[model samples]
Target: MRTHRKVLVLFAALASALAGCSSGPNQPDTVAGQFADALNRDDIAAAAALTDDPTRAADSLNGLYDGLGKEVTFEVGSADRNSFTLAATWNLGPDGKNKWSYTTTGTANDTGDGWKVKWEPAAIAPGLDIGPLTYDPVYPKPARILDASGGELMTQQVVTLVNVSQGADTAAVAALIAPLAPGLSAQSLESDLAAAQGKPITAISLRAADIAPVQAALETTRGVTLAPQTRLLANDKSLASPTLSGLDDLWQKSTAAATGWAVRVPIPDGTKRLAGQDAQPTPDIATTLSIDLQHAAEDALTPIAEPAAIVALQPSTGNVLAVAQNAAADAQGPIALTGLYPPGSTFKTVTVSAALQEGSVTPDTVLPCPGVANIEGRRIPNDDNFDLGQVPLHTAFARSCNTTMGGLAVKLPADALTNAATQLGLGIDYVTPGLTTVTGKVPPAATPAQRVESGIGQGQVTASPFGMALVAASLARGSVPAPALVKEQPGVADKTPEPLPPNVDDQVKSMMRETVTGGTATSLRDIPGLLGKTGTAEYIDDKHAHGWFVGVDGDLAFAVFISDAGSSGPAVEAAGRMLRMQR
Candidate 1:
């Protein structure tokens, strides 16, 4: 009986210790329960007040739940008198595929009312994750006029006039008074008269010879009756600047009004003009165009009368300093950096660079220029019966002998030629910030025949004036800088890399120098160190050939492409004018 009592006493002591362990001092669940109750009651202020660090607690809660776009649940996992643990789950988002989990700890705080939950720095589970929100950027509408640097150049604005005439058969009247109208059209005269008057008019059917007496009589009588049952009135001359054409195509894309009457235009000034109202201040746009250079270029190209484009760039940075579109301005397309055209023999610079890099040719490499060479079952000929017999590589290049370049291309692997072309910035998409630009084409396989043509800048190859300018610039700087319109901010270095090997670059520079000294570009002789190449490409169907010249000064490079023009005096003259401006 004594032994049994001792065993019972020991069992009772073990039970008491176990109960004490189960209770523990203060568990995380105790705090979590109070916090959960506060949150469930929809009392955000009360819940915030429960934490000792109320601001941090509010921030933490907002970070977890503010933009959650779904309801969240906080479960009290364990609790004691002074602390608690919580497990939380929330819907990921509208997609509902994503789920989030969080585990947090909290401490009990002695508020005047009772023990409240104070959040401790909690350990979040799975971390915070976010993706694209509702605020993604949308592209804007395209603009009409793009500047040389590919920036938006023009904005739509309104021009208003007081009196615009809806006149009758003015063309007929003008035809009747042919000698009197002289250079003026009947419609234009009627339109001008209607604009002068405040109200619209029908028809003015008198000859220019008949107007003087009628105008004097109208001034005398304020309004006058004329002979043969005619009526006369003095003409008013109020004209509006921002006239709209009422054409759907013109108005739909315009931010300005399109009515024949004056409509409001959103100009730089903060004022608006109503239809038939005059603008408070006239708007004018200053252009980067040099009229003198433009006229000179036009005159120089008059001999060939070809469609052409001349683009000049500052070499250190590729800013388009000037651009000239030839007679066929409408046909030439946009004045973008990457306008496409056959590079012609001007591409020989690339060939020389490739040859030097491959070690297959040197400055002194002897080449036979027989005027024509048969390679890969195709015959390639030089321009206009020109041949440099048994000449050095430099001399052959200066002369732009196709036969010599053809012979060299036959020795190089197709891939090597392609790689070199790629290095020259071919076969890549070029994007102008605010304008459309074309990327010239280069064939993939580049067969021996293709290689030969490409070597001479023909066959399946094309480049723009801007593209060629980049080539000239690369040669000038020994590396290519990223072309930019806007001035770069401070601490930003240009990140573009050099496209060609240094040795190849040196060879090209020497060859180009020879071009200026004695080659096809000898026309530029007056301008010293005017390194350049001249190219004339023949097209089918008796179309006039394309002429090209790309050159570089110390830190200036420019390319001129004259299209559908005969290659002779005009092309050379254009090149001379461009070089003189640089000097």
Candidate 2:
């Protein structure tokens, strides 16, 4: 028994000695854990203290963190008495989509009083060489914005960049160039040239097509140098510039550092796009625009010096055929599809539909048409307050009798216009990947006057040119055809079509045709099968009105608009021009 007790005592002593050797105040794993915590917390001084070359390693870690960008987290993956590995993940702010993750491993050894990392470049990045590193971001060729006919609406085009070097006359150079590109300001060019650094003077970048009209004159101009550069853009004076500008933003966002981040390599030329090059692969998204119709719509707005927009749609398919906006309207951000404005008397189509459904009026039903009628004590007047005493509903609509329409509003519910507008594909709830639109707005009325106003396409009744075109399309097709700009399988059409009252479509069609024959829209008489409504919508203040024309001609249905046009004459003229061009 005494011998067994002695053996037990000896084993306990050996176990204690082994435990002592295995752990200490400066053990490898403990040191590594502290280092990782310090690194993660950005405690440069504390982390440096744990390394052999304190200052150098801390500086290295600082550079590493700086390269990692905004957010980064660190963890000690594996640790032991002699070795440890750390895993780190970094996010380069919102500007970068991808996160970078890498693991760093290093050895640890006892140095008299404590354990320290055998610091080396590999401990920061595996196989990292001598010297600082730089990140070079690479950009891909912007994708082409194509139309339904597979025609490129916005494509890669060459442009000329004019530069004024040392001792050059900025005014003379700008004067020569301004005639070629009207948007370019000679005074601004002179100012820019005066403030230029390495490059003497930089002028506006002119599209090759824009400069072609006066290439002869530009060649003869003095004190300037021109260089050809390539970029994605629309044709000169095209309405697709806003769309292209949006695409350019996407391209900028898609850019990132190239793979296998290097210390030294020749950077690639950004304009060597994969679009036309066989050496690389990229994307080109297809949309449902029509280049031919888009140009026709642009030509239609040529005569209107004010801000104007025109949109065209295929009635059977609801595909957007064209979206064109005059230069004066471009600042409004693709107003053809996104601008919201009161529809004015053009909204009577919806009001009539509601009235027919509610059994309040019919084509044969005769209604009041005084020069001015009072609805709920609010006075309502027709266009120029022209009275057509006691006319049929059909004749009243054909003549755009606002006073007569106002009478029907007093008989219907507040949501009547809202429901009718929704049923007609206005204010449709939908989302397209790379498209924008404002369907329409028909808010419920709080007062009889408001309801009467809504009846005449005023008050809360609003629409974009795109939205008005859809309403015209729905009336022409006898059902609400879904509108789409992208090739979507079960897209806008999948939305429930608003049921129209029986023969209501036919009645409205007849009245619209009558509008061209002997009504307010008589300007469209020369356009065969042209059935339409003309509106001069009052907006902003008393005298400011917007011109609106919505119509259907054969397979086409469209809307034209001109801001502050006072009357629909300009819109009608633009519509006529579009029809003639399309024909």
Candidate 3:
């Protein structure tokens, strides 16, 4: 009976122990683990239900996650009846590969009911704040727009923007900005101030130099606040404005990816650059342009307010040395490389070359230089009705005799001019990157008069400054050199349909030299070894003419075009300036 009683006591004690172990107290770790799973699933309601302050806790987690949130996972480190700690890992996505791990703690207390957890912002991320989280985008310093010589064309600098606030004195803001930046009209500012409907905003932007003289006075002026911002500016605005615009475009394309930096703070004043990096570093843009030459070109055009373009190229390699256009011309777009203008008398170079190649004429072949030559019943007269009389084909070319060129076209086949122009680097398209250009157009003539007009570069033959420069370059190189804007830019120039007679190029160059020496281009006679031709193209109903000069000196070849120029002298003078400015 004693043994049976002892065995029952032992069984009872064992059963009570098992019950005590199985029915453990609600642990903080269990709550914490459940909470972590709820957050991972984005089940805010369930996660908050387990916390002390549901609304406040859920809000904090939401703010911490920002957009699209992330994945959450936790490991219970150590736990007790009153408190427990955990290690949480957050992933920007469900991918565990991208994770940020942090330690968090929670507390649970039983008040005669089920255990409830104490939640805080730190439970999501340590030191997590209650306000909305924002990422400020930071941009790297603008990469330099470099010249061919690796000098800075455009660089980073400080600029001031006068901002206006509607609540401030309206009259004072206009008066302050007027003297500092004369380009910004005071009348327009007053109108803007009166018309403004909202809070403070930028009214006008000015370079630091524009406001330097009156900076102190402007600073004391009321109602207008000066906000200094960092941006790219040309080293000399007068010299590079319009050209810089194109190079600026190329720079923007190169650095587009590098500008996506999102930092912890806003872009501040005098902040030269942002510290945070988002992408590959910006690559400096290297160009075939010399800012020095560009400055000279700009200076040359400053006096002339008409539409004009100058294109300079190195004859040895066909690399573009400089491209500049007056503001009036640039306002119409990049006319220097792409504008279509009649080659006019400059086409005589091509026509004479074709006539010489086909055994129709020779450098010494005497062609009639009548004041007017009838071609298909159309009267063609030389400029100012002056004739070279009976002279060699070369002399007729030197004098830019329209009558002789028109007569020469009458004997040639229609495609002769077209084929010849293509051989001289015209009537073809290009796909060079960062280059906006058109080669030229020389359609085969259909009528006898059409051929005559095309012969003198008038009827349907059109060429850009780019094309004319290439004509001079082909004459200089004896063969057309391939044009290149960027040093390693990939492209190929179209081949001449058929090769020119070997001697034709030599004859062509001699004829060009005659023009500059004893012919129509007397303005360039003083320029030693100056080989060129001049053209006065009558356009716009013959009311005005566009002056053109294409020339070569040493390894440099260039073309100048002036809109509405009464004579070719202006273009000749500009070419002279360019030649003297060459280093």
Candidate 4:
């Protein structure tokens, strides 16, 4: 009876062990059913809470559903106390027609009361299909605006090296590297390399080791390499140090205009700062300048071998039309708008206007012109070195008689002349797009001689072709529009222009018309409806004269000035060419 009791006790212990092993339901659906119910109702939060590692399970489900082309269903393949396996079928979309199958395995840990599923996808199944795989493209950035209308223009750029080797002779290496790095400053490059290495690199000699990491990084990240012998040093071998110096000098002048525009650059990943980097590349500016017209203007005036300036603008819109300065032969600096010279006889228009506005004289007023006129103990002569006996104000202007203009200058108070010049946009800084402009001085109030000369477009009086063109433009539109390089912006487009009184503009227009018709600028007769004025301003030494001509057609206004060149003949010729081109 005792032996029977021992067998029964041993059997009972064995039964208890087996029961613990098989304690979980035969079907793993118990937990899976709850997870499926939550998923079927689109309750991600509930489904996530039911698992031991809900966060991981939820993330996996999110990734899977995100990539699924359709809806899906789950099935239990097998189950045990510690683990379970599931098979799933998904419909690509809401239609639930297209389907895909994936097999997943899950493991459960014994909780105090029951089994709780661990949320590891890898542990579940080897061939589980989470979803389609995707990766970022190698070249994922936007393309840059390379060129406008496919024409070569001046541009700037910064240069740098990746995975370059550092050596003791870094400075020497940089010197050798200068020519290969176009638009990059060697000093700047050295500074950057020094900072990158966390110490001063007096010299750099790159070898295979220094480049390995950079090469590896690029290859791994960008899937590309620096091509063999693609280095710039070999191509620039023939360039001498002096040549580099000359290039540096030119860059300074060209970059001066860069202050007028904004620059854009791409920020690559892992780039911390641009500090100490090589000088950035300079971008080319697309200007309103007409290269063909500029070349022609240069050719036409250079033959006379004189300093000159010319500017053309649309009368109605104030768009700069064309400009030419000193001849190409004598090419100095950019002469388009910065050249300053005396206005000479051209200033008579300003004097005459002042006189009319001050009620000192009118177009029909008679003025004494007996060969010469004495004013403030000085004799002022006409262009012929003498003046006509007595002539109407208009006739005096037409003949460009200096004596009459000098007499009128004395009669008109200095303030009147100053006000007229100021109203016409002179004696003030003039800023324009993509170009530098000279203010062109006018005589100050303190000096009588300066004021007299200023009245006659001499002495301290100076003006650019750009300013003169603006004067003509004022006459054309009964106002002046601010000159611009880019298209005018909205809201403030018309504000740039300053208006003149209607009567004043009309009188100037009539006089300008007479000038081209039969007066000083008869050369412009071929240009129908053209109105213009010519000036032959004399310098103190009388060695050379500055020639000027300003004119206007329907909606275009232009001015030309030739420096140290006698007479306005060449300027007139150039103006005619420009006018024809415009037509």
Candidate 5:
């Protein structure tokens, strides 16, 4: 029994010794645990001190921390008296978009009096034998803007922005760059500089060809800096300047979603790819514009001296085919899509539709075609007061008899014109992507005088070229269509109008055809199946007028507007030119 006791006591002593070895301060696992804890807390000094070579370890660890963006997590995967493995994960970028994780193997050595981790670069990451590590990001190519037929419209181009600091040499900078850019002057630069309030103002952004001649001189100028920026620009600036400017925001959004990044090591020649993802660009953005039609519209407006614009749409699909404006029109902004003006005789179409819907008059009903009539104290007159005694409503409409339309309007309900205009897509608000538009306003007329004026489209009634185009489209399609610019993003209208009655639609269409055939738009009659209306809207006074013509040829609906044109002849001629090219 004494011998058994002695054996058990010896066994107990041996177990206690093993336990002490595992938990003692000199144990290799204790050093490994401490090293991992120091790394977790980002204590580079403490972690390096626990390594065999403190200086070398500190240098490598500092580089690792910086290269990994200072966001790292270290966990002890396996640990023993002499060997250990650590799981390291790094958060490399914002929003947790980039992460790198790997397991590294290292050894702990007993240094007679203490235990320390061996200094090896592999302890930080697998296959990492160098002193420094780097994270390199790769960006994808920007997406292209495509037309409805998959033709490229806009692309990423590099442009240099010339910025002037608060104390910059304004005179010298302006003089050097003024000739390169149009409409820039030294006096204007100084005035703009004073308004900057100590902030740097960008004088201009120039294409590569525009700035190549002065690039060297501008770079040396004091308080001036040239910054290169990648921007989405039209492949042909002359095609659709106003419409293409609206697509920049959408282009940037698509590019960001497909951006890719990578981690790489710097070599003597260039960079050695380490771990990364290759950039894959997103699909091209498809717009509703037809490039061929856009070019044709632009070409047609080139001969006009006044500020003229043209807006075209596909009546069947409500796709915006073209929005073109001449240089004279560009100075006034995107007037083709947003500028509101008195619609003149173009609104007669709406009035006639309203009259037909009320059953007050059919296309065959006889109405007085007086040259001038005092309807509720408002003097309504035909073009040049030319009278054509009692004729059918369709005949009076085709001839654009204002007195006849005013008489019909004064007899109907107050909200008749307003409702008709909305049904034709003039008053409804549209939220279309890649385009900002204003469809003009048509207010309800509560009195005979107001109705007479609204009926002839002269008072409190307005429509944009885009709105007039929609009117023509509605008549052609028998219903109002939701407009769209981007193929995938159809516009949402604020209100859904009821479809036009079949009888009303048929009657209006027949009158429009008669107007082009033998009415005010006979000039465009050469084009087959063309239906149109011409307007000479008086603004401010009777002396100056804006010319307008809205028409539909098969599936194509368009509006041509010329500011201060004095008559509708110029607008009709421009429309003829535009339509002829499409054929």
Candidate 6:
């Protein structure tokens, strides 16, 4: 009986100790863990309920969660009855790049019902009790685009962005905005709006001048919003608008590196910055374009009614000096640099160069230039059937004798012209930065007929105005210089062709000079020491042709093209007007 009583007493004492242990240190640790779990779950109310002052804790927790409304986690370290280490982290930026992590001490008190965390702002952050936290973004200023003379070519400009909700009256929106936005139609706007399905769709972005007439009306319309935005734009709207537009993308990329940010506390007077980084200044982008020459080219092409373009380069360096196109040509896109057209007699430069390299003929070698001739079953004719019979190779080239060139092409190897064009920078691929370009394509002729057509720049022989300008530059420099627009960033060509022989270079230059003095391009003879070639390329039919003139004056080499001009006269005249400005 005594042993049984002792055993019951001992068991009772052990039970009492176990109960006390459950309600003491272990309870505090359990409560701390529950609070951390609640916070990690974003349950501010549940987390506050585990605190001694629930109301105050709820207020601070709500503010902290709302102010930094991003991903957050709380980890509770080993806890005693009094305190525990709380590690908190908030992912405030993309991919946790701006993560804020810190360790704070949390206190727990024994309330009558259970153990609860002691309420204090320091439990969240060391100084979070001061006020609510906010994220302040610091935007870096965009870089300026500079011309060759170190003048600003592109700058930030304010514009209005118009948007329409899906259910808005797209017809009314389109009718009001079509006048300001080119190529926008009511039917297309309605279709796009319906496709967006309640999403806000951008109607148009209008400059100040473009929005002045429609701003009030657009603002009054329902489901419409007009937001002002800053965009990189040309200083002068007329100065290489397409090129500047492309540079805007590059400007955006340059500014995308680092966006500064600050964590602040809002107070009665002004916010106190807790931590932040200052934005880095972006460097200015330099281009190889000459302002004066670009303006000159633009002015020279203004009077032409048809689609016309001009491209000029510095032969010594292959730096693009100017690229200008008239409004008609602009409607067709950046034709001065990318558009391909039959080079016509301008390709005689390549033909003659190829023949010279093949040891087939000299500039003085006699070739027959008939009004019309059938070579390899292909009919070739001189301009207006006016032929010079039994003329020197240089005279035939200057006069652009298609029959002579076609006959010479039929006698050469298949890839001769292609190789020559590559050497002259025509068929070579150039990955130029800040500018998207296609020099041209000269494929190898598989048949004599194709060769005959390719020789005169008709069948498979096509070139951009930029490519022809490069050809002239190569003739002037005795080799093709790598073309580039961005300073210190030369284009990487796929093929590094050797320079032409001095004899071939001199012969081509002499013939081109004769072209200006007495041959087909006599119209430009007034421009002293001008070397050029005239071309009339038939397209679709023999009645209509594109006019071409590639020329060199001093260190400047240029090409002028007039679409559907029916003759090379207009191109020659345009070239003369352009060169007259250089003097």
Clashes within 3 Å, all models in order: 13, 0, 0, 28, 0, 0
Task: Give the top-scoring candidate (TM-score).
Answer: 6
Residue 345 in model 1: shift from native, Å?
0.2
Candidate 6 at residue 162, lDDT?
Answer: 94
In candidate 1, which residue ranges exceed 4 Å CA deviation? 1-184, 187-304, 335-338, 489-498, 541-543, 581-583
Candidate 2 per-residue lDDT over residues 396-494, each given as its tens digit: 998999898888986789888888887777877555444566778888887888898899888878898888998999899988876666556224433
Candidate 5: give the clashing pairs: none
| TM-score, structure 5 vs. true | 0.73
Over the stretch 151-259, how does candidate 4's per-residue lDDT look in tens digits? 3322232222333333333444444544545544546655666676854332322234344534454334321223332111211222111112222343454443222
lDDT for model 6, on a 0 to 1 scale?
Answer: 0.84
By how many angstroms RMSD does model 6 differ from the true structure?
9.2
Which parts of model 4 have CA positions greater than 4 angstroms off? 1-287, 290-296, 326-330, 445-449, 489-499, 581-583
Candidate closer to the true structure by TM-score (higher is better), 1 or 6: 6
1-583, model 6: which lDDT tens digit per residue?
1121111011233334335446544465667778877777777889899998889989988888777764777776644446777887766755545667788998877787788888988887756889878766666887888999999988788899998886777777888998777788878877888888868889888888889888899998878899999988888776763566556777876776656777789788988877777778888999888888888888888899999999999999988888999999999999988999999999999999999999979989999999999999998988779879999998999888999999999999999999899889998878877777788999999999999999999998889999999999999999998887888888899888867876788889999999989899888788889999998899999878999999999999999999998888899888888788867
Give a tens-digit lDDT track for model 1, residues 55-141. 866665555445453245555554444545566554443344334456665556556455556555443222222211111111123
Among all windows of 10 consecutive residues in model 1, the one with the lowest summed lDDT is 236-245
Ranking by TM-score: 6, 2, 3, 5, 1, 4
Winner by TM-score between candidate 4 and candidate 1? 1
Give the range where candidate 3 is weakest over 10 consecutive residues by summed lDDT: 1-10
Question: lDDT tens string, model 3, 452-547?
Answer: 889888878899988899888877887777777666663375554466779888898899999999998887788899899999887876678888
Cα lDDT listed for each candidate: 0.55, 0.73, 0.73, 0.57, 0.84, 0.84
Q: For model 5, what is the alpha-carbon lDDT of residue 22?
A: 62
Q: Could you report the Cα RMSD, in angstroms, for every candidate shown?
A: 20.4, 9.2, 11.2, 18.3, 9.4, 9.2
What is the lDDT, from 0 to 100, of the residue 345 in candidate 1?
A: 80
